[model samples]
Target: MKIGLYFGTFNPIHTGHMIIANHLAEHSDLDQVWMVVTPHNPHKQKNTLLDDYHRLEMVHLATKDFPKLQPSDVEFKLPQPNYTVNTLAHLQEKYPQHTFSLIMGEDNLNSLHKWKNYEVILQNHSIYVYPRLASGEIDAQFINHPKIHRIGAPVIEISSTFIRESIKNKKNVVPLLPEKVWHYIDHNLFYKK
Candidate 1:
């Protein structure tokens, strides 16, 4: 099976994420897209993030109805910071029979050099980059790489930060989040100011 790893914090899985994952699964060469919920991202601010288990549950509730999209909690047991390189290595070791690919936004690709063991990741795995609103073109060096593919998935400007802020300000985020996710957040009083 060809699995595309779509790694994110998924503070609350929203429609934008679902659209991209579905697009990748249906349009790309991937058999399924696993939304890998990272417990902690080394590059992101830690204080703003919700608990790992809460974030994982939100992803589960949001993706439960999508057959091609699977929510993954593999990083919950991994080390802190949850580096992509380590996750990829671990997944490869654990599931040798499955061919894994990396699904990311074009913005991430622009900063690929800043990541740990990026060269190893590029050389070993296929990267499917979807367009991001305002994210510029990829670097010239990787423009023609065989393993790097730029897909035409629709770009949604909604972000997790925006969702959290809206919730804190008592703004209705029903349009941004999945129904079950919003219900869970509201019922649990998540992100209350």
Candidate 2:
């Protein structure tokens, strides 16, 4: 099986994330797209992040209706400050039968060299990059790489940061998130300021 791993903090899984994942699964050669919920990202600040379990549950709620999309908590049991290279190595050892590819945005591709063992990632797994709102054309270096594939996924400007701010300010987020996800957040009083 070819699985596309869409890694994220998913502070709250919103419509943009869903669209990208679904598009990858439907349009790409991937058999499935797994939303790899990161417990801790080495490059990101942990201050505003919700509990790992909460974020994972939100991903689950948002993806429940899509058979091709599923939520993953593989990073939770790993060490803190999870790195992509380490997770990929672990997953490869555990699921040798599955070929794992990466799903990311153009913005992330801009900083790929900063990631741990990025060269190894590029050599071992394919990358599916979707365009971001303000990101210009992909860098020339990766434009024609055999392992890097640029996809024309529908661009949704909505982001998790925007959703969080709306919730903190008591604004409606129904259109920005899946029905079950919004219900879960409201019922749990999440992101209350």
Candidate 3:
């Protein structure tokens, strides 16, 4: 099985996340898209994120209807301060029968060189990149790389920050989230601070 790993914090899974994953699952060659819920992102403040299990639950809720879109807690049990290289290596060793690929955005591609053991990643697995509203230029070396595929996914500009802020402000952000996810956030009163 060729699985595309869509890693994220998923503070609260939104419609945009679903749309992108569904597009890749249905239109691309990937057999499934696993929404890997990271415990914490090094780039973002840990305090700003919801509990690991809560976020994972939201992913499960959001993906329940989409068979090809499944949620993953693979990063939850991993050591804190997780790195993609380690995750990839672990996944490979754990699931030798299934090939795993990365699903990232154009912005992330721009900074791929700085990640630990990035060369090892490129050498071992395929990368499915979607467009992002970022200004950083993608390094030239990745332009024609056979391992990196620029999947023509729609430019979903929705931000978790925006959703959090709206929720804190008591705005109607129901449309931005999956119905069950919205209910979960509302019922738990998350991001209301």
Task: Tell me the whole-model lDDT of each prediction, alpha carbons only.
Answer: 0.90, 0.90, 0.92
Q: Write one digit per residue (lDDT tens) for candidate 3, span 45-110.
A: 677699989999999999998999999999878886888999999999999999999999899999
Candidate 2: segments with Cα more than 4 A from true spot: 41-45
Q: Give lDDT tens digits, candidate 1, residues 26-112.
A: 999899999998786666777768888898899899889888899999988898766788989999999999988999998888888
* Model 2 lowest lDDT segment of ten: 39-48
lDDT for model 2, please.
0.90
Q: By TM-score, who's the top model here? A: 3
Better of 1 and 3 by lDDT: 3
In candidate 3, list every pair of residues with a backbone clash.
none
**Cα deviation in Å at residue 171, candidate 3?**
0.7
lDDT, ranked from best to worst = 3, 2, 1
Candidate 3 C-alpha error for residue 44, in Å: 7.6
Model 1: residues with Cα > 4 Å off, grouped in runs: 41-45
Clashes of 3: 0
If candidate 1 were superposed on the true structure by all CA atoms, what would the RMSD be?
A: 1.6
Roughly what TM-score does model 1 have, to 2 decimal places?
Answer: 0.94
Q: Compared with the true structure, what per-residue lDDT tens digits does model 2 show for residues 87-155? A: 999899999999999999999998898889999999899999998887765667788899999999998
